[model samples]
Target: MSLYSRKAARLQLNLRKVAVKGGLAIGAAQAANAALQAAFIVILARLLSPADFGLTAMVFPIVFFVTMLQEGGLTSAVIQRETISHRELSSLFWINAAIGLALALLLCAGAPLVATFYHEPRVEGLTMASGGLVLLGALAVQHLALLNRNMHYGRMAFIDVTAAFVGFIVAIAVAAAYHSYWAIWLRGFVTIAMTFVLAWLLSGWTPGRLAPVSQIRDLIGFGGNMTAFSLCNYASRNLDNVLIGKFSGEVSLGLYDRAYRIVTLPLLLINAPLNRIITPVLSRTRDQEERYRNAFLSTLQMGLLVTVPLMSFIAGNSKGVILLLLGPDWIDAAPICAWLSVATLLQLAGNPMGWLYISQGRSRDLMLAGVANSMFICLAFVAGLPWGALGVAKAYAFCAFLSTPLLFWWATRRGPVSLRNLVGAISPFALVAGCCLVVVHLLQRSRPDTGLLFLMELLTASYATMVLTLSVTRTGRSCLAQAWSVAVSGFSMMQMRKRSSYG
Candidate 1:
């Protein structure tokens, strides 16, 4: 029933082909983007200060909160609709544009208030400069959504990476030249410009005119629940930023934000590519109950398998990861990174549930689940306020993990991916991580000058390698083989392109 089975049937075969090609393209694009971003972060952190990073961090969450209004799932609505009209697309585009303009003005007006909230007068100007990205982002929404609906990811990949590269270059240059928060603002401006360029280049089709009132109304209703769910999800994820800025100060917020970035980076890497590829695919087979069931389970299986080891390794080697990746200045982030890494890993278990809901047209359930999750998280944050950043992270992670079963129960209706499947998927990495912890402790017998940092790295690397090695079993071997094939094919294509150009 699933479009993705081990068997080499025709439909499965074709789906695999599409997934292989699309995933590889998006994955490579993301890798380039991540590498560029990492370079920017590293260089910028050195050139700039934690205070600078924190200031940008302080401005971003408020900006993001406003920007989320522009995205209200109109793109996904476009994608999920089996037959979209020119009128519908055109109408959505205009609506998003108007929303973007309003949000831009709103952001400008709120800058003073935002600055007041953080007690940082500097934030007012920074926000005013950065607020334009919302309108820029809004402008491209319908165009980008149309591309996703068509599953034109190869084009999408090119557009995204090119824009990101431009943004990074602008930021780095501005940072080097001015050595001011202007670099932060420039990143947004350049990103928006690049997006506009790419949107125009990739989206060959253009809007004609707005749809009729009735047509627009229908699409809005369809997208409403998805929008509501997204809003709640955004707030829940961003609670820490708001709390840190309010209680701990900008510098503290900066530290926590950097740590949060390190923890969630892997998830972003996974989610961006997988979500792009999976959602459309899921939408295609939504009506076929058996197909939906299988696709959903396969996705969950892969998500768990990948998420666990990464989280385990990070949690086990938090100290070294922080020092090596972020530099010695970020030593304060080690514990926060460790706990939040665990939290994100736990969060991955529920990742596919929303997709399943959307595919099944259970939008109300999606919104309800999101609201519940967000409310729970907010309450947890309030309770943990006294303990500071680490306490907040600890509390957040606990709440996220606790919500997994509830999410699963909602998604499955007590069907496949039962408690046993969940445990089985998670247990391997957890067990390995525990073993790595023991080894780390043993190596820390003398507690060398570097302390647990060096020892933890060795322990984690060894454990992760072993976990991966054991994955050579029948079921695991197949997935590994497929992944390997995808990687090889992608690299080969790149090499071929290079050779042809040179010759």
Candidate 2:
């Protein structure tokens, strides 16, 4: 082969190696995090009351809003940029820090307003206490961004696992001592604080003098549009919590929050890594049409294969799942969990498309689509407010099912990927899920549908059915082939100690 072709092949191999290893590291870390949190919540639920969780849920929307501002979406700019200088990094760091401090102060000041809105005096302290979160989140963004840009996902995964461990320890201790909601809030604060410190230490980049704003105006513009999208998306996702805490009261909100977590935990595992890896890889391959399209579609297929059936099982057996995870004390949360799992299954279809826009430098499209999607979701939340948390979950699921098609079309149009390609990709996963749901429906007719044994029986049957079906499907075999290739490649550089410092 010619030297040029040889070089291209090697570069492609390296990228695949990095992407595969990064996915594994992140997947492993999130799995560990899920295990730790599952254990923590199991114990915490026994120690704390639903009202306690409700109090903190009231402050989360505001916290999430500032959390969006603190990053300013510059992390994406850093990763998506073909090149960046230390001066640019320094400027972004300072910008992030400034945003963090300003947001921290703002949140502290507005804590009272959050309490007032909820008519719950307990939320005031929780909101104010979360003031530091904005700062902590902001400070870490640039550091983590550089790591991602450099393909340091293994290190990032390590940091994530370590931070989660620390948070778990701190939360357990606090709960043992006080048995209050503060334990839950402090868990997050401590985790972010740890991540900020660890991120800086491991990231190896330090701020120098800031560059002139003119030097980064384009980046700022790109980031600002991304930030707009995030804000809208966050509002749509969290508004239910805000509304529930406001109208349905603390106990109800707490139940819904737990149910939300139950469904989202698996998503976090699949999504956290994919979202981190997509832009950096896709950005580099934008000019390579086939490569870009395959990366996005393959990622979607593998992610859905792992995630959807699991969520379907949860949705079908939410009562049993809840009983196993949170115990009978949260039995009433079952409907919310089931509906939320349904919503998640539908929404997962569109999740990967966010990065498609980012990699293509189409933040304008992202922001516009986010606005429309959020409107539908927000309206659903409002409509369900009268019926309470379960009502909200059902509404959200219905809306997601309706809006998902729009997202796919909007994201794929005018890009390397097309609506036809999307439908081809999604069709397989949908078929498998549809089959699983059908089997689950048939099984629901059986007697003795309660207790641990019944739950296990149903879970086993659902998964076994899914596995048997997927084994026969062409897409499933392809996904399996992808996994096999990644495994057999076994790049030596995947081991962090053996490789050069990615930073």
Candidate 3:
């Protein structure tokens, strides 16, 4: 090959290498997080009443809203920008800190309103306690963004896993001792604080003196658009909880919240780490159209491979999973979980489109899309509200399924990615996962027993079927081979590092 071709080939190989390593690192970290979260939930659910969970859940949306304001998407702007200066970083940092403090105080002041709206006085304390997360989250945003920008997935994963572990320990201990909703509140506070401290320690970049603030106006503008998108998105997603708490009461909201948590756990584990990895990687490769397209397709394919099967399994076995995890009191959440699992499955297929918009500087399109999506979601929630939590869940899922195609079209219309490309990438995995889901659903229906063994049998059959089918196909075999190679390389690299340290 000529020198330019050789350079391009090398760059492509490097990208693959980084992606593989990053995926493995982040995947492991997220898996650990999932486990910890599951354990925390199981333990806490047993200790606390449903009303306690519902009370805590009511405060989450408010805290999340404040958090959106505090970060203001400045961190995303930092990562997407090809070049950034100390002055810009410093200015953004100060701006974030100011926002964080202001929002934290605002949450404290508004705690009473939240309690009054929910008709539960406990919510006020929870809201006030959770306000500190805003400042802590803001402090760590730029640091985390810098790490992501530099492709420091391993370090980022370490910080995240460690923080989560620490938080879990504290929460578990506190719950064991206090046996109150304060466990949940303290968990959020401790986790955010730990994350902030570790991010600063590992990032090793300090803010220099702030320079002329004029340089960061464009950054602020970009971040503002992102923040607007986030606010709309947050409202769409959380309105259900707000309305449920208002209309249906705390106990029902608790059941619904738990169900939602169970269904979305897989998405949390898969989407978060990949998003952190893909956004920066795609941002760097935006100029290379073919590479960008291929990279995105591959990532989407990988995501669907995991999400489709996992969600299908969840939907098929929702009753067993919910009963087993959350106990009998949460039985009402089973149907909700099943429906929401299907919804999440459909929603996840279109999740990676954000990378395209953000990386390509299509923030305007992203904002508009968010607005449209939020409106649809809010309407669905409202339509389902009169029917209670299950109705809301069903309505939400139906709307998600209906709007998913439109979401894909809008996200891909003006970008390198297209609907055809997306369908092509995800079609095979979707087919395989669909077949597995059918078999699993049949097995569950035939057995009609919700026990640990039955659940295990269903999971095993589903996974084995998926594996056999995938192994039978050339495309599936290639994906498996690539995944195995990455896993082996990651293991060997860790082993070598351990040996080097010993020597």
Which candidate wins on TM-score? Answer: 3
TM-score of 1: 0.88
What are the clash counts of all predictions, listed in order?
A: 0, 0, 0
Q: What's the lDDT for residue 148 in model 2?
A: 92
Give the TM-scores of the predictions, in the order they appear.
0.88, 0.95, 0.96
* Better candidate number, 1 or 2, judged by lDDT: 2
How far does residue 9 in candidate 2 sit from its true spot (Å)? Answer: 1.5
lDDT (10s digit) by residue, model 3, range 97-165: 999999989989989998888788988988887778888999898988899988999999999899899
Q: In candidate 2, what are the lDDT values of residues 1-503, reduced to their tens digit?
A: 99977886787777887888888788789899989888887888889989988888888878888898899989988889999999989999999999999988988898888778877888888878887777888889999999999989988998999999999999999999988788998889999999999999999988899788888998999999999999899989899998898889999999999999889887788887888887799998898888889899888877887887788888877887888888889999999999998899987887888889999999999999999999999999999889999999999999999999999889888888999988987786777777777777677666537677876777777767767776786877777688567666554545554566654
lDDT of 1 by residue, 1-503 (tens): 56554443565556655766787788888888778777776777767777887888888877777777887778777877778899889889888888889888988998999899889899999888756788888889988888778778899889888888898988998889889867976777787778877886788978787778886675687678888988888888888888877888777777788888777776777776788887787777765555655665556555555655666667766777677667899888889888887788777767767676666566778888889988998888877768888888889889887887787777666433355555554455455445555554455444543535564556556556645654745445554555466568667767887899999
- The whole-model lDDT of each prediction reads 0.74, 0.86, 0.86
Error (Å) of candidate 3 at residue 195 is 0.4
True lDDT of residue 28, candidate 2:
84
> In model 2, which range of ten residues has the least summed lDDT?
489-498
Query: Model 1 RMSD to the real structure?
Result: 3.8
Candidate 2 stretches with Cα past 4 Å from truth are 1-3, 444-457, 490-503
- Cα error of candidate 1 at position 324, Å: 1.6
Clashes of 2: 0
RMSD of 2: 2.8
